[model samples]
Each structure stands twice: as structure tokens, then as C-alpha cells.
Target: MTKTAKLYRMVMDKHVCPYGIKSKWLLEREGYEVEDHHLTTREQTDAFKGEHGVETTPQTFIDGRRIGGYTALRAHFGRREADEGGTSYTPVIAVFAVGAALAIALSLFAFGAPFTVRTAEWFVAFSMAMLAMLKLQDVEQFSTMFVGYDQLGRRWVPYAYAYPFLEATAAVLMAGRLLPWLSIPIALVIGTIGAVSVFYAVYIQKREIKCACVGGSGNVPLGFVSLTENLAMIGMGIWMLLRPTL
Candidate 1:
């Protein structure tokens, strides 16, 4: 006899709970026959919740025993709990990945070649612009968090607010191949400052803090990813400075 699982979920016309769909999929994947009970109306949903003595929907029961919500079901399967603190590198990864793809596409369209010295330049410029945009979204929040580690931001608070605009300007100027004298120095100075700040904060001080790379709200830990971002900018700045000479 196959052990049947019962799932109580809210499936109204205007509101279809996402957890309920996930719960159903999970139960099916686990080889359990699910008896789905949909609370279609508000009255039914309220009545069901009152009867079950539960506050939320998507409740699961296995073999006549209650298994609670999606979190509880995941626990029963020994899965790791999801962090609510937004402490994931997913946003950073997504931004960088998309920027790289866009850079490559732009390079291919402009130079008619996928791999070129110009392509690397484009990649760096795009990355800088994208990162700057993220910071600029909420400059106040970003500056507040940035001052925690950045030496310059700590001393001169306005620098933190100005940093994103500087980065964006440099990126735009470099991408346009305009005013090397201004753009190159801007990139070089900011990149140098960023790299030093990241190194001092992560390596020298050994501080475990959130990175303001993506935004103030993001919880990306200050470490290798942050260091890499600064290094990339520094390398790009140096490359641009030496390109004309080489």
C-alpha cells in the first residue's frame, strides 16, 4: 500500500500560494501520492486555518501525521535551512555574469570579433558601470555601510557618496574612448583606493563584514569576491593607462 500525503493549500483566483506548488512538487518527487486539498474561498481558508489551529497555509501531513509547513518538510528531508538575512552571493554572481555576457555581445557587434584586447576593456567598463549603478541605487545606504571598512570613506564621508559616480563616469568615458587624461586617472585612483581598503579590511584587520559591492541592503560577505572586484578595477585601470604606450 502506497503511503498517501495530504496537502492543504490556498488556491484562490487572485492569490495562489507559491509554497503550496513547491510542497506538491516535493512530495511527488519523494514518491508520495499527494491528496491535495485546495481552499478556494476566503471563508474556507479561514475555516480550515481555524480548525487546524495554524496561522499559515500549505500545511502537509504524511500518513495521518502533521508535517507542518514547507520549512518543516525540508527539515524532515534533512535539507539546509534558507538564510533570511540575504547573505547570498547570488545577486553578485548574476550581475557579473550578465555584465560579462553583455560586454561580449557588444564587443562582437563593434569589433566583429568575440575575443580581442578591446573585449577585455569592454568587459571591465561594463562591470564597473553595472556595479556603480547598484551602489547608486541607494547611495546613502551604501555609504553608511562602506564607511565601516573603507579608510577614505571613514575619514571623508563624502568620498563614499562620490565613489559610485566616479566609477560610472570612468566607465562611460573609457567605453566611449574619450578623454583618457581624465578617465584613466579617475579609474586608477579609485581602483587603487578600493583595492587597499578591501585588503586592509579583509586580510590585515580580519574583519568579517558585509560588502557594499552590490548595494547597502545586500549581505555579501567581505572576502575574496570583494577583493577580486577591486583587483579587476585596478588591473583595468592599469591596462588602460598602458594601452596607448604599448
Candidate 2:
């Protein structure tokens, strides 16, 4: 006997239900032959909901048992639901991915070169500026998280607020290869402080904490990524200062 499932989802002119599509795809992936049904009109959807005594679209049934919505289907299949406040690297990964793409695009469009040392430079600067932008959105919240681990942020309240601005300014100037005298020192000082703080807190003390690198609203973990950000910043600073010699 073949396993079978039935799915009903909304497919409207303005919007198609994403969860509905996901449910159908998931059923198919799990080797279920799905009888896909689309509630094209609001009235039809309402009638179905009223008849089933349910409140949402994208209902699924397996072996004549009502399996609820997409989340419910995931539960039925024993997949872990994403915790809203759980630690994740998604935000940082997204920022880095976008920064790298932007760097490559800038290199190709402006300089007509695909791969250059400048591309690497732009990627670091762009990630720095983007991360700074995230922190600047909520300085109060960011400072709360930052002071938890950063030695300087704990000693000076103002440094927590000023850190984002400093990072952004240095990044913009460094990307332009302008005002190296000012940018290099700012980057080096902050980067050195950040790297040491992260190392001590996460590696030495074995303390688990949230990172302020992508701002306070995110749940990005304070570990390798936070260290990587600081090391990249420091590397960029040193490279910019000594590039003429190499």
C-alpha cells in the first residue's frame, strides 16, 4: 500500500501561501503522494476552514488523519522547530555573503578586474561597515550585550556607543584607501581589543554569550565568528599600513 497525503493551500492573485507549498514539497519529499488542492478564493478558503473547524490555510492530512499546518507537519515528521531566540549564525552568514558579493561586483564594475587584493579589502571593509550599521540601529541594546564581554565597553560606557561609529568610519575610509593615518589606528585599536576580549571570554573562561557584532536584536553566538570579525579588522588595518612595502 502506498502512503498518501492531501494538502489544501491558498493560491491567490496577490499572494501564494509559502507554507502551503512547503507542506506539499515536504510530503512529496517524504514519499507521500499528495493530492494538492488550492483554495483560490477567500470564500472557498473560509468555507473549508469553517467546515474543518480550523483557522488557517495549508491543511494537510495523512492516512485520513488531519495533520494540521506546515509546522504541525514538521512535528509529525519529527523535525526540530526553529527557536526564535536560539543562537544562530544565519544573520552573520547573510551579512558576510552580501558583503562578499558586493565586493566582487564593485571590483568587476569599477576596476574591470574579477579577483584582486582590492576585492579582499572591500569585503572586509563592507562587512565591518554593515556590522557597524546593525549596532548603530540600537546602541543602547548593543551596549548592554557588548559590556557583558568587552573589557573597554565595561570600563567606559561611552566607548560602547562610539564603537560602531568608529568601526563604520574606519571601514569607509579604508575601502576608499584614503586617510590611512586616521583609519589604520582606529581599526587596529578596536580590533585588538575586540579579539582579546572574545578570546578570553569564550576560549579561556569558557563563557557562553551573545555577540554584539551584528547588533543586540540578533541571537548570533559569541565565538569563532566574533573572533573572525576582529581578526579580519586587525588584518585589514595592518595590511593597509604595510601594503606599499609588499
Candidate 3:
């Protein structure tokens, strides 16, 4: 039988307010039943924290265990969530990897094969390299964006340093089909970023940014096609997260 656990998020401050809401959303997404207990009064909140040995709001108690806050919860749940999701979408991810390979091949073949693909290409390549690195250590590259590559401060934009080398390693591994396990996660991460970039341009950004996805000089708008591509890639990532290892 599945375990039923109670989680309590103490919302004391407003700055940390979004933490609770985001926590609730994540739990719901993972099919968990969250019961909220709002303690606005200092006396009540202090007493509650003391009882649980918690020193802050947005404190989470999982099955009676005092799991600190957002980072704490992430530490406990992130891998499990990734594992659960990854295990369910093995087939879907395989299909996505195949499709990605075909797209790259076709695009290369169609455009008369440029001497090299740069920028986004390198970023994607690095992502795959990270995947291989993670699989070697039995970790999940859940999202394509790596904290290691975060150099744009609050923007979290990827840096252009050493990305090509990183991705090239993965591409080499992939070319030889040396490790299917590693390649799958790599593809999922790149596909997701591509999809999200396309989506943000369409829905959030609301600007027709050209899809430099494959390193072509083509400037395309944020059209329905881009949205569809984004959704498809995100779907692939979701599936990879859910699918099990074969």
C-alpha cells in the first residue's frame, strides 16, 4: 500500500509565502494530499515550531518528520519524483531521442550540412554530456538547466564556456551508442529547454523570437508550430522522468 503522510507548511513571512504555495503545487502534482495549517499569530507559530523543532516558516513536516523547508523538501523528494517519472516514460523518451536524432540529421542534410553548429548546439551538447555524467553517478538531470552553468545571475542564462566540449563528449558517446541510459536523459533535457524556450517566446514573452534551435540562420516567429514543438519536447521530458529503466 502507498504511504499516506501529512505535510505542514508554516507560512510566517510573506517573502517566503510563495514557498508554501509552490510546495503545495508540487505535492499536488505528485498526487499527494496536503493539509494546510495557517498560524498567523506569533505565539501559535512559535509554539508550533518549538514542538517540531523548526526555526522558520514554510517548514514542512512529512509523516511527522521535521523536513526543513523548500530545499529540504527538494532534497527528499526530487530524486524520488524524478525516478518515479523517469520509470514511466522509457518508451516515450526512446521515441523522443530517436526523433531528436532524426531532426538533427535531417536538418543537417536539408541545409547542405554546415561545417559546424554553434551556440544552442553547444548548449544542447553540454546537456547530453551532463546526462552521461549523471548516469555514471546514478543521478537525474531532471531539467536541462544545470546550476553549474548558471552565470547570468538571477536570469540563470547558460554560459557559452566549455559547453561545446561537454556536449561533444555526449554526442560522441551517442554516436557510438555506448550508453543508451545516459543518452536518453541528455535528449530529454535538451528537448525540454528547446520546448520551453519556444513556449516562453509564444505565451509569456509574446515576441516572435526566431528559433535558433538547430543553429540555422533562419528567423522564425513564435507561431503555433513552435508551441507544438515546445509541448512535444516537454512531454518527452515528462515521459523520461516517469519512465523506468529497461
Ordering by TM-score: 1, 2, 3
- Compared with the true structure, the alpha-carbon lDDT of candidate 1 equals 0.87
For model 3, the stretches where C-alpha displacement exceeds 4 angstroms are: 1-3, 10-16, 79-246
lDDT scores for all predictions? 0.87, 0.93, 0.48
Candidate that scores best on lDDT = 2
Per-residue lDDT of 39 in model 3: 70
lDDT string, candidate 1, 156-178, tens digits: 99999999999999989887767
Better of 1 and 3 by lDDT: 1
Score every model by TM-score.
0.83, 0.75, 0.30
Q: Write the residue-wise lDDT of candidate 3 on 1-246 in tens digits.
A: 444445555556653367777767766666677777777667887797788777866776667777777667777786444443221323324434654565466446756653333222432343344333432332222123222222221144332223333344545544344464775565555555545555555677676443322222222333454344434434433443464331
lDDT (Cα, tens digit) per residue for candidate 2, span 181-232: 9999999999999999999999999998899999989998899999999999
**lDDT, candidate 1, at 222:** 88
lDDT ranking, high to low: 2, 1, 3
Among the numbered candidates, top TM-score falls to: 1
